[model samples]
Target: MEFFNNHTKLFTAAALLFIGLTIFVCIVPALKNQSENAPLPNAIALSDEAILGKAVYISNGCVACHTQQVRNVDMDKVWGSRPSIAADYAANYRTDFWRNTATVMGTERTGPDLTAIGQRQPSAEWHLPHLFNPRIVVKESVMPAYPWLFEITNKVKKGDVVVNVPVEFLHGQKGKVIATADALHLLAYLQSLKQTKLPEGIPEPNFLYKKSGDIGEKTAGGPKELDGKVLYITHCQTCHQSNGEGLKGAFPSLKGSKIVLDENAELFVNVIMNGYSGRVAEGYGVMPAVGTNSNLKPEEVAAIMNHEKTNWGNSAKKVTTEQVKKWMDAVKK
Candidate 1:
């Protein structure tokens, strides 16, 4: 009764007990887990350039918009092959003991997940311009341009890496836009963000959502039949737009494009399957291999070609799946 009446003693005891429990229950267990767990066998340490670029990424507040972790969910399959495990991040070091420095497994996803961005969008040709002016590549992109990371010079040195900025995006700049070393470093870091493969004992990826057909297989008039409108919306609308009028300086318009109206579909099919860089054109940027990336089928390609040919006040012959398949086979050869 006397001890209970002592408020000062009671408070001191409670404080000490709480502190002790926190150390034993939280701190000790965490330290133990960290110590016991080894980095995944295949986890590669970041190169010096990538490490520096990581600093740049952190300083630029990129972590606020992009996430590194891929969750175990159906929707997450678009970002990575499988859910990220803790061992994936074991090689990442903390900036300091008190703060979580390097492990930037962000919570918000203002941008796409970067767990496997290296594999997904590896081309420096795409990323450099995107960093310079995201809208130049993706007309609807809301990402801010990091133009400061680049310099416009009339005379590009022999060894300097040049960014192929479209004339419209250049805004009347005379010289070539050169990527700074920092930009290269940042690119290296971004390219280093590939998802490490799990070890033998780990379970294989279990995707929740499964599509029925193979890459080039689809039924005629069935639900699996290539919906040209849907395909255009999902893949093409971002750059080419719903009206088929592509962004002027970034992407070429498809509404009345010569390539789209051409009698022979070889070039068009090749462009979709392989990708195209229109650097010689004053206001055109690179087009990624949409068909390859989306795993589009020959029927889907034919459907898209037909839709584009007929839409936006254009009249042309519908492309057939057989034609697309023939072109694909030729390309492979």
Candidate 2:
């Protein structure tokens, strides 16, 4: 009571209490984190251009819609190889005095998670047009276009980076789409968002609540099927479409296609792994090397092939994983 009656004593006691808490709660954890977490071994530092792009990403409020973190859940396995760890963001610090931290690990995911978007979709060809107008690639996409990031010009300068957008989405403009510096920068940043592989021998965190009898390859004991439908949607559906009827004058329809129906399976595998630029004369843009970029396994390729062969009313011969591996190895050679 006597100590409380002294105003100075009371004030000093409260200040000391808060100071102790500041050290224990905030400062202690930060110090511990410095020792506990470090950037992944294979993780590359962001380029100067990517840094600028990160600023653009932040300014455009992309953080509001996209998430950078992949949670430890079975559903999020599609987003990343593994759940995000503290070390994943160890390098994400404030770029400058004026800017906030670049660790925009957002909470909400209105759009797909971008934890490993760099690996999933590495094509500048796809990203540029998609950025110009999401509807250009995905007909039912709800994302708004950022047309301001591009320039429509008939005279493409030597150094100008052209965006390969479809003609219809160009509003009949007589000019090639050029990517501005900002757009390229943003792409660099987006491309830099690949999750680093964990060091070998260190156990990765398992996803919780994984369903029993999940799809995978048939091994020695039993058959575990990989979901070809999921793989198709994740990688190819945007360009080829869910119905296999690709965009007219853009992506070639996979339905009843000669390459798909052929028993050889050479061209189909080649196109998926190395991409198809031969269709440029037929008014289609270059298909990205999805198989290579996604690091798809032989079993995954077989699953996608089987899915395409069966879906969209096409009754082609189902390809086996062993068959796919043979062609995949041949192509690499």
Candidate 3:
């Protein structure tokens, strides 16, 4: 009764209760979230160039179509090795007084998710041309080209980064397409989008609700034969078209290539495993090490090779997993 009569005492008690409630409700949970969602040990901090690229990414509204998140579903597995986790986005948060930027986990995904793009497509050669014109690499791509990020220069300087665009895609421009600072920064950011690996012994989160037909099955007469058409679409269709006709002067066509028709697959295996880095000098963008990047099994390689050999009227000898394994082992220098 005495405390109620004293207004100051009553207000003091109410203030203490408010503070206690805030500590219990807000502060404690925030601290727990911070501890549990700590950045992964394998997480790499963004480079200076990547930071600037992120700013460019934001300004261009790239988040509108492309998502950084890989949802926990079997269909999303193609975008990442594992399901998206809280720690995966821990590094994307930057809390400070002047600037507070949260993760760019976009809401809608018109384009494919970019969570593991760095691991999937690790070639600047592919990226540069793709940015210049999405149709150059992916014919049906709806993504807009960022041509403003490049400069057409008569003479590429000593340290200039050249973007190898198809001559047909250049639209009568004769000068070399050089990557400006913004383009280089954007490439750096895209290359840094690799998903962090889980710690050793920690069980990776399973992609829930897998479809029955998602896996390869054994044939009635032979061993398991994965759908090579599906594999080609997933790994190669963007650069090498569905018809096996890659763009002229950019990506070489595999339709009638000697490498595809060769009886001996030594050179073919080497090209897939290590990539043809020398292709840039030959006026084509370099091929990426798809086998290394995607962790392609011997069976997978055989399937792709067989698809390339048989399709587009090539009629080359179909490869087997055992043959591919032997050839792969031989070419591993």
Whole-model Cα lDDT of every candidate shown, in order = 0.80, 0.86, 0.86
lDDT, model 3, position 300: 87
TM-score of every candidate relative to the true structure: 0.68, 0.79, 0.81
Candidate 1 lDDT at 31 equals 85
**Alpha-carbon shift of residue 121 in model 2 (angstroms):** 0.4
Best model number under TM-score: 3
- What is the descending TM-score order? 3, 2, 1
Model 1 misses residue 237 by how many Å? 7.5
lDDT string, candidate 3, 92-130, tens digits: 656356765567889999999999888777678778889
List, residue by residue over 98-137, the lDDT tens digit for candidate 2: 9756598998999999988887766576678888999877
**Global lDDT of model 1:** 0.80
CA lDDT, candidate 3, residue 144: 97
- Poorest lDDT segment (10 consecutive residues) of candidate 2: 213-222
